[model samples]
Target chain A: MPTDTADPRYDYALRPPRLPQPVDESLASAPIDLDVRLEMYRKLHLLRQWSKRAHDLFLQNLVKGTTHLSLGQEAVAAAFSSAMRPDDYTFATYRGHAHSLSRGMDPGEALAELLGRKNGVLGGKGGSMHLTDVTRGMMGSYAIIGAHLCIANGAAWSAQMRGTGQVAVCFFGDGTTNIGAFHEALNMAKIWNLPVVFVCENNLYMEYTPIDLVTAVPRPAADRAPAYGLEPIVVDGNDPDAVYLVAREAIERARRGEGPSLIEAQTYRHGGHSRADPGKYRPQSEVEAWKARDPIPMYHDRLLKLGTPEATLTGIERQVAEVVDAATEFAKNGPEPGLEDLLVNVWADGGAEWRN
Target chain B: MAELSYREAVAYGIAQEMRRDPRLVMLGEDIAAAGGVFKTTVGLLEEFGPDRVRDTPISEQAIIGAAMGAAMTGIPVIAELMFSDFIAVTWDMIANEIAKTRYMTNGQVTLPLVIRTANGGGVRFGAQHSQSVENWCMMIPGLKVVAPATPTDVVGLMAASVRDPDPVIFFEHKALMATSEEIPDGEIVDTLGTARIRREGTDLTIAALAAMVPRALEAAEMLAADGISAEVIDVRSLVPLDTRTILQSVAKTGRFYTVEENPRVLGWGAELVSIVSHEAFWDLDGPCVRITTPHIPLPAASSLEDLAIPSVQKIYETVKRTIGGAP
Candidate 1:
């Protein structure tokens, strides 16, 4: 809730690198209205709190199984959600709890899913790693690296063929750039001229190893974009305004049937890859550096500077806290699905029986 | 009535459905302009136009994943993997994404798509391109697997697969492509999960699929000359396996034999044998036999390749030896 730039939670001494102008020159100075900015800020906080709570619950053994948290990467999800229309498709990776929330999925249903409760999204069948709700245009959160990029193109192809004008926004990690499907998807998207945006949330690390160590190129996603004939657009992923501007430009371009864009959002994860990984391999100093540039606090400071009322910010924080608390309680009290739930949904007949 | 080659039936079936539904789209390598490597999709590009019929890059992952994504949304797609053996490259998309999405999402999404691939060995395409990988897809939980033997069945089953609500892996046998059969002139649509009794006899039951079905039928004719009556059943769909028809045949004949194109270990026949043994234990007079290709990567040499896959001679000899020795 602190509005002061010198708040102890953030390290003001270590400045984030400035963005090298907007990717689309036409939208270089396009303004983000106060209302949209405030909404993005709200989404950022909601995501931050939801991810933090899920991590906490994991520690307590309430949220079973492993989960990948995007603690420091809320800006990309919030900014993209703000820019995209309600009906625009989103295909993201396992580290997409925040992305699902940003697309307006009820926190309670998502939390229930993570908790393996019966009332959860997908009826608790898809755990944290596979959180999906198609009704909200949150298509799916694929666990395998780089696969969703190709799948996203299929959605884009559908839109193009159907003349829906809907663009598919696929999200993945920097590690995905090394996968073959990533290349295949990009090349095919270009060849077919499909309406899709491939967003790479470059958290600087692929699991335990730093991306730079394994990746041959300096920039994993952006460097490879030119190979697919796409302009390499890299943005400050922690900066809400920078991500918002780039996301809006790329999304609009795809919606207009100009083919896909590869945007590399240089972000970082506050925690390890998953609940099991403590991320001991990463340097303490480097972790602290990325932590200092957390998207939540950075955007909070930006809003305060933009002349947002202090009371309004405090009220939003209060609202987010209550929503997170209610979601926690609902998930805790939710029911466990019965044994019969196992055989259902395997086929169209709603049963797993392969034989008559 | 009209006579169509198995390869021609593939195009006719797909076109039949594409004409019925505007949402159905087809994509594969060499399928559009080149009319497919097996010539199964000839005239489709011209019939449906390039918009519905597309030729993708040599990217199995993209082709299958795009089909899944399109299926998840409103559009239903039919993707071809060129050769069934190439499924190894894009197994994740077909097995993990397309198969599990509907179940994992609790029915929030339905993937209405068919992955048509040329399967089996006989024309010496080698190990990589000749595998009858229906077993690979059969083991997956959320997949519907169908392999048709005759041209008429190909057209009918293709329509059934396309119209089905779930993902179907259609195995078009490479060896059977040149074979032709007569069919009704009007729209021909066959039901999946139904076994066709190719030839009826009482001594034993021969269960087979795809390329193996013709060999089994020929073997039955050879057995009949020796007064050994054998009933050949074409097991069309593997996932919704016609266990009812198979169990009934086993109960009546008291003998069961599976002529499989896949290798000996863990073939689709293995599952059927397990089911028959458990369900019709009293009805079965002896152990079920599986005459299959040896567990080795298929050799490209013509003689060796012909020797490896199940042949009519092999089916006839295996059944005659097993039945003659049985109680």
Candidate 2:
């Protein structure tokens, strides 16, 4: 059961165009400043624990509506977001809580939105699936899979039109690449040379089903990128540095108006599609193997191997925990929106635009 | 003070807006190099350059979805669909994504964009290519629906649609594109929920939309010959409907009649009838009437289509019958 190394007996989803592994050493040193790398590790660490706490809240029936957490997929969210600038907009999918956090939406506001609190981002109108902080360039979260791909391309087009040189990053699942919107959006992005980065969270499974069953293409989905005239970059998603390196390159390409790139981050999710179901379909051995490569513990061990002092590591851990604890309190204590806010911001001058 | 065809007016309206606002751009299949199948966007690409007027692949969902994104990012876009029937294919983007984004985000986002598609079935484009289901768009919240009857209304309402803070679906009729009229050159009437009184009368109110507006005018002339004075009101914008004008006209005429190309059951006219009953039931001298096509899928044959689609003759008879039956 000890998954310290890749067991030849177990399948690591090995196929042609094989993606790199989490333990790939060459991919680990992503050229990030030591302090910033450690800080990103801190954020990934908080996301790892925050997802667990959120799942616990869901179990207690405290969280409203359905919830999808990126428990084992923190590295992709953290690294890609770290590579992004503040003005760069990002469009995320339903399992986008970590994506929002990485974009600087306060954990408290995100949690409050999930809990339907008035003080939450978007005044609780957009729950976990539709989280948005437009000012910080988190355009919005889409519950519909593959729906935001074109929207991301549109945002990229906006920047290109304004000559802002800003990039638009879209975070979707492996399943999304099959949808018509994905193909349409990618084709348009490439045809127009749009400044967008499409990062597919290739988490092996699309909900309860293995992606192979639902899609004609193989895992990581980026193999089809060439057909759309876009270069595909497959990386070890569980390794933050690997994800960071490729994401930064693609984002820079976008910023320079070199068109779009597809990064198929071969990561895994440790939880169900949402909070209600346990991911019983994944093989026990495969789950344990991926669990062994869990981004938080894996990165922490890497940091330790780099000879960070034990006290410094503990201090970083304590800081992340305090922030998470404070976020939990803030979300729990946030006020509920009043009746008057039912239709605010819907129109210019607030004089009933659409008539509901 | 120059006269223009509906097609010319459409092109001019968009050109004026693009010149006025650098943020305004347009995209669709063949809209760029080809100017568009209807030629409404003829000179736009040449005028604004390729960056502003883009021609996209045959992907309706992507076109609308990209426009929503551009609109959110402060770039207002004019997305064109070659035919209105394709809305059925792209309704998910229009209904689920674009329509719900604003309200769902608690107004954190505003989609200042327009979806310009040629609607109605008079051109024998068959079932797949022709439709007037503005009613389908009518049901969705957070969307404004506008169908302009003439060159003037087309240019004016389109300008309004481009400037509106929310998403607007601009439904242009294929049959009316070649129709010419003296539209005030470069006039941008940026208003919604306002109806235009085409011709005044006293006996009954004939509320028509898009292609039906011209037919209704013809019907009014035919009715006037028979001493059945009919006041014609072009129900220009469907959503945020011009209820005040329609109701006031109906109150004066004592009868109401609607004509549209869509199917009769649960059609756009049904919504108008409901609004009239609720708001002006007491003013009505008789039951409201609607002259709409049948529920059957539109046949390809021009002869067969003529049997189903509403015409001036149908509107005249429907108005005469409604008023004749009334006290």
Candidate 3:
């Protein structure tokens, strides 16, 4: 099961074996209505299809900027979005299309943003790496590796001081764990017992280098929670139900003033780091191996086995395709921002003297 | 009218503002229990409690960052950095986050954040503690930089700064903290971008900031004895500079002398000269003069520090030379 070589077979065997059976029997006992589960699955599928189309558009030069496609990281975003309240603040890294889309951003606006059109959520000012819609509680997606952690912490601290029940969630890659701001933010959040959730999507690779080479710790990224005086949870990121159950508990824990939790979702990116990378550094077999545990197919099979009809699944796929198609078309016809917009919003009316 | 020190005036202004607005809070190292290293925040914690008056860890970055967070959430935060030199530690938050957030957010958000720090060289605090860095904040947009010279000006300017919709770097001269002046009671000074004529004359116009305002007035009195009429103007704010008043004075007098405690080269004095030269070049009878510190750090010895910063004698000589009275 060693992932030391470029061979596909060894990498396939290296992936953790599938769970012996469904581990969510206790969670299932609560009896979530089938309609809710189906809706969540449909949304998750839409994010996946939208990201896949983004990857394709990036390769075909239809999209102007580089994209951090979350091909194999859909369930975590879907589950976290489903479990959190609308008013709760969320910040994510550059690989944040799925996160933004799941948090109620209009798919047309999201696609327009990725396409770098004037109709983007940031009015084309923030492209793929910096999509922000504060109105929707999506604080922003930062390009600076770990800077958003402090921003999220500040937001959470403000929320705590204001006596707001809203919690802040920050999403980052495993690479962010090596940064100073990450440690500083975690220490502050712990000391203040601020309502925040640090979700690390451990996709095993930070850009081209694997996590093992970059990270000092052997366990999942969240395992360092003991040092921060917080409980850590590791879940099968590819399993939607597992992600949903753990995210629910974490969100509730934060909402109840119990401080923060570090949830490390053991996942993978089925594509390259960005549109420019073909992922040649990763062995073909490793890529193929993760493909078997692809969250989309896994969730599709689980839904069918759990009494979802084939016609219903087909209908969801068709709906997702239409949504993505319409969004792409909307972006294709979106207007470009005027030159005057560049000077707009630089300062308040009275503060314009500084600009001169 | 009651006589109050500049430091006392700052404290009273903060106290009055805090009393007026419950959302106003203060944070800094040694600002709570120790009442700040300079005692400017004495009795604030007792009056306002820990939540409103906080003593933060020695980390300047954290102090400024926390203030930024509080300000972003609708709280007006008055953060003290102890000394202006220590502002470098939190420059990233000040320059990048606090100063830029309002503009970057497209004016949808306003950062009513005030960072009060002491600067100047007469206290013999040496190179590290006595540098005047107001020009640094002046270079940044979306920030209002103010340097108040008098006790009344400090009270009024501080209140205006607290109410400003943008981030403000309020510089108080360490030497002037103990200087006393008669301040008006029960009235608030609201105009921040306007300059005040401390002394009126026709021979030369002297523009000064912070501690130099008194030195300019002293020089004006000396110049008046020699039949060299000198007008003194206190530039209370730098960013929203009252260029109109300065140009008008320069045009009428035909001679300008800019004074500051900072090093001579590229200082605010140079900037003022440039502004006056550009705006009133036709009215200038002689080259614009500037009285400023030498291009070196303030030394530790009191005598050496006195030599480093511009003094009343130095300002008088500059004014005399500008008015053709140097012989």
Candidate 4:
């Protein structure tokens, strides 16, 4: 599907993100051009800005129900988004705002979805927790903890059966390892040798509790990978370069029919789990420590160290701000869905009636 | 036309569809190589090869979720949940994900898939294995529920479910697995939301599903001997319920009885009765009664299980007692 033909900015074909080449298998030796680095910076800026804005919308009582914001974990989404093929599939959890946007979901439509507007990605049907745009291969934002992990395997299976080299990247929290579906999905994916990459964004906390307190394993996802005959891959989720390197390897491995990989990306959610959580449970010292290692500034500094001009980085930030502002305006001004919408989309015929 | 056992009809139906739709895949535990625990899918693995007719682990969630995911991506799948009772383990995938994805995404994703399971009991499989849970799927909005009674309906309905642009729960009655009937030649694609009037009469209407349909038909036969004309309708589909056929049947007979193998509480019959009472209120002469298993787990003992589930005698007696008639 061709996206935003009218607007070249959103046209992926017009300006594709430069990722690690297939020939350059080693991320350590691979030279990422300044353009790709800037693109990564742009995505990071966009994700952080969009998440904070969406959080504000929730605070203003515009976004109904709860919104799970990926406030601090922009790098994982950005890195994977950059590394993934346009045809590759993404299955994300409730904390998937960044994942959806990284897949080129229109910021306006995403915000409108959060605001329950008719022009929303799902036409106000799937609220904040379920932002989906299948055209972009953003399959769904699954609210259920471990369900999509199993579902992602199916997509991978489909890709394998059809001989389509599309890799399915499934994103989940650290706590998902304990869920039955998680184990089931991993085992099946390995046995089938499916083209899938299970990326666990270990945000330290799962909902309210710290993940380690409840989880038996030290590394929730990576530690358990050995049981499923997969390598225990750990990446710095807060570092875009680090995640991008790991994501490229796993994605390539899956696409090459090397089966599935479980990567536990260590990261932190800047805000509470959702709009309802104030996150008072965390010690102030721990909170400050994670906040200091915030991804956006870290990436910006990395680009500067790599000889990218300060003006170029600030220019991307400016562009990101404009996009976010426009999206917010569009969402705020978007119309609510008509009452008739309630009856449609329940079936393929676009009607909810079960019987005559 | 050739006669096929209900179990054979299952394999035939799947084979017929798998041949037609290249994208169609089947997944379940012990389905392939082992020919399914019930042997419903005996030849699928040999015919389609391992790529399509692969066996899954005992992960019900993985099987159903994989089906939903495959369906979402244009590969229509037919997932088997060995027994209907195992639905409890994968309820999150079926009820929340598969049933709601199309709606939640505003029709962005249409899961053209089928989750076929061996349902109900008569062979003493005990409580867990012997359950008629079609009512569970019927209540879910996005699912199209069907329980085919005969071998012919199994072949026909399986075709419909495979071709339909929605998720279908195809419930094959465990007891009816051995029952054989003549299936029409060529492809047997049936409609999803239509009811089949197995027998027609004027005195009363007895609507039943899957295993209960045979009992209802038998009871109708006994009722005829007693000089009471009874119509037996095979309610194959529960979600896109054939209320039109049922209401018309009730209007003609002026009396209604639902023979169900599900427990007494919130059975599929309850919904049909509610719809019938409201729409065909003027046509009904007396209160509609439901003949179902008592709201308890089915016992392993044959005598107790036979007593628990509505029998041919029970169906015969219920109608005979309600609208009293004797030769």
What TM-score is obtained for chain B in each of the predicted models? 0.98, 0.97, 0.97, 0.98
Give the residue spans of candidate 1 off by over 4 A: A1-30
Cα lDDT tens digits for candidate 1, A1-356: 65556532333223232222222333223498989988998998899898889988888888998899988889999999999999999998999898899999899999999999998987889899888889999999999997899999999999999998999999999999999999999999999999999999998878876677689899999999899999999998888888899999999999888999999999888788898988755556667777777777766766776678889998999999999999999998999988978889999888888888
True contacts kept of 1: 0.83
Report the number of the highest-TM-score candidate.
Answer: 1
**Pairwise DockQ winner, candidates 2 and 3:** 2
Question: What are the DockQ scores of the candidates, in order?
Answer: 0.80, 0.57, 0.28, 0.86
| Per-residue alpha-carbon lDDT of candidate 4 for residues B1-327, written as tens digits (9 for 90 to 100) | 898999999999999999998878999999999999989989888889988998989999999999988889999999999999999999999999999999999999989999999999898999999998998998888999999998988998999999999999999999999999888999888999999999999999999998888889888999899999999999999989889999999989999999999999999899989988999999988889899999999999989999999999999998888785432
Q: List the candidate numbers ranked by DockQ, top first.
A: 4, 1, 2, 3
Which scores greater on TM-score, model 3 or model 4? 4
Better candidate by TM-score, 1 or 2: 1
* Local lDDT at B134 for model 4: 91
lDDT of 2 by residue, A1-356 (tens): 64565543343332222223549765456477777678678779778777777777776676889999999899998988888998999899988889888888888888888888987887887788898889889998898877699889889999999999999999999988888889899899998999999999988888877787678767546788888987767888898888888888999998987989988988888888887768766667677788888888778877877777768778888887888788888988988888788867655545454421
Weakest lDDT window of 10 consecutive positions for candidate 1 chain B: B318-327
Model 3: lDDT of residue B251: 86
Q: Write the per-residue lDDT of candidate 4 for residues A1-356, one digit (tens) a residue.
A: 55536432433223322121121123333466667667888999899999889888877888889988888889899989999999999999988899999999999999999999999999999998898999999999999999999999999999998998999999999989889999999999999999999999998777877677679988899889999998999887877777887888899999898999999988888788889888765666666777878878777777776678899888889999999999999999999999889899999999998997
The TM-scores, chain A only, for the candidates as listed are 0.91, 0.91, 0.90, 0.91
Measured with C-alpha atoms, the lDDT of residue B177 in candidate 2 is 86
Q: Which is superior by TM-score, 1 or 3?
A: 1
Local distance difference test scores for all models? 0.89, 0.84, 0.80, 0.89
* Runs off by more than 4 Å, candidate 4: A1-30, B324-327
